[model samples]
Target: MLLAHDDEGSGPAVVLLHAGVADRRMWDAITPALAHTFRVIRPDLRGFGETPMPAEEYADADDVDALLASLGVTDAAVVGSSFGGRVAMELAMLHPARVSSLVLLCAAYRGLEPTESVRTFGAEEDRLLEAGDVGGAVDLNVRTFLGPEAGVAARELLTQMQRRAFDVQIAADQAVPGPAPRRVEVDPTAIAVPTLTVSGAHDLDHFRSVARHLAEQIPGAEHVELEWAGHLPAMERPDAVLALLLDVLRDDPTVHAP
Candidate 1:
């Protein structure tokens, strides 16, 4: 099924894949600017926003490919945040012809052993959900994902997005019970596109490690660590992230200083 998405502007295509705790709306702060220079496509992945959870087996990479195909886009630069970053890599590896470049923001890597902090966060989130404390779960995510640089508005926005995602996912779980979908681990060494992995110093060690691993494994991949960010730097400091994105997306070797 084609994912629900917003396609704006008219230039080279650029797709923004959101984090697990967020929907396409997470890109709202910078989409307008990006739209002026490129065709920006932001999709609500299944079980996250307007898209419903799949009733049958499906891969998110395939879903994204389908969405791009429907838009007549043969290839595009892709940016993914957090869990979205994993999906971005999957797309590049599985559908190499579809991706022109990749930018991963505190991305999650499949098969990476979770750090103690990450495990603790996951367990608490599960406990909250199992206890029917959806609000608490949302709060947990806001606290865990947002950095010190994040302002009140960012925190509130994350709270709303996380709450919405939980509502959609929880309702879907009640309607369809099954094991988690299988994921195909990406072979980073085979990725040939210009790739950049951005990590936040304040993020969990697991994600930082994943960023480094991707940079090392993916030939020609560049890694940048943001000193003032957490797991979700885009939300924490949209303008700064936007500037960074503009520099990289322009594909000017001299523009990307950091």
Candidate 2:
């Protein structure tokens, strides 16, 4: 399938993948800085943004590989947020040669088993969406995914983005049916690529858990926690996130240094 993408800058290739509810547009805050040093390729994932879905059930890794191939990118470092991070993990495992490195933010992995809060929230959101209460779904998403300190304007923008995300999913003929689920188990030790896992200090506990798991299990993997941020640190703390990303790309030994 042909994927929709936005490419910028001119240097070593780097692909930025967005979270499930957000499209490639989520990278708008930090892409400019990254573009200064690398060729940035941002693609709207299937059922999200302008990207149309494939005819058959296709893994996200396959879509990513196809996208890079189409762009004539033989190798690249990948930066993925949330759902996109999960896809990056799969790509690192399935096609390590194409991926030069990996950076994951507020990524979800581990397993399908959810905590009590996650379960309750998921059920409620599903019920609201099923009852045609899209507004409620948007509100719940904003409150849950974003930090409480987020400004009203930011929350509204998030809601709008979510609405557009839902519309895109609905428009896709091959969108995944039913509720989105997580992997049963993710063995970071199986990943061969150099990896960097990042999480917001105020993010849900699951993200921290995943980051810790990756840091400990994946060889040479590094983990960083951003204070005063939640699930979307790249949005909430763009400067810090960009600095960390650049340090990782430059292979700086002391990334946390001020």
Winner by lDDT: 1
Cα misplacement distance, residue 91 of candidate 2 (Å): 1.1
Expressed as tens digits, the lDDT of each residue in 1-258 for candidate 2 is 767899999999999988876788778878998999999999988777787554456667877888898889998999888888888888787677789999988887855456677778889989998898888888888888887556665666677778888776655533556334223235687878888888887888777777777788889897878777788776666677788889988889887542
What range of 10 consecutive residues in model 2 has the weakest lDDT sum? Answer: 176-185
- Model 2, residue 160: distance off in Å is 2.3
Compared with the true structure, model 2 gives a TM-score of: 0.90
Per-residue C-alpha lDDT of model 1 across residues 1-258, encoded as one tens digit per residue: 789999999899999999998999899999999899999999998888788786678789999999998999999999999989999999998899999999999998876899999999999999999999999999999999888999998888888888988987787777656325558778999999999999999998999999999999999999999999999999988988888888888977754455
Instruction: After the best TM-score superposition of candidate 2, give how far the Cα of residue 174 lies from its true spot, in angstroms.
Output: 9.9
lDDT of each: 0.90, 0.79
Quote the lDDT for 183 in model 2.
36
For model 2, the stretches where C-alpha displacement exceeds 4 angstroms are 110-112, 171-186
Query: Model 1 Cα displacement at 182 (Å)?
Result: 3.5
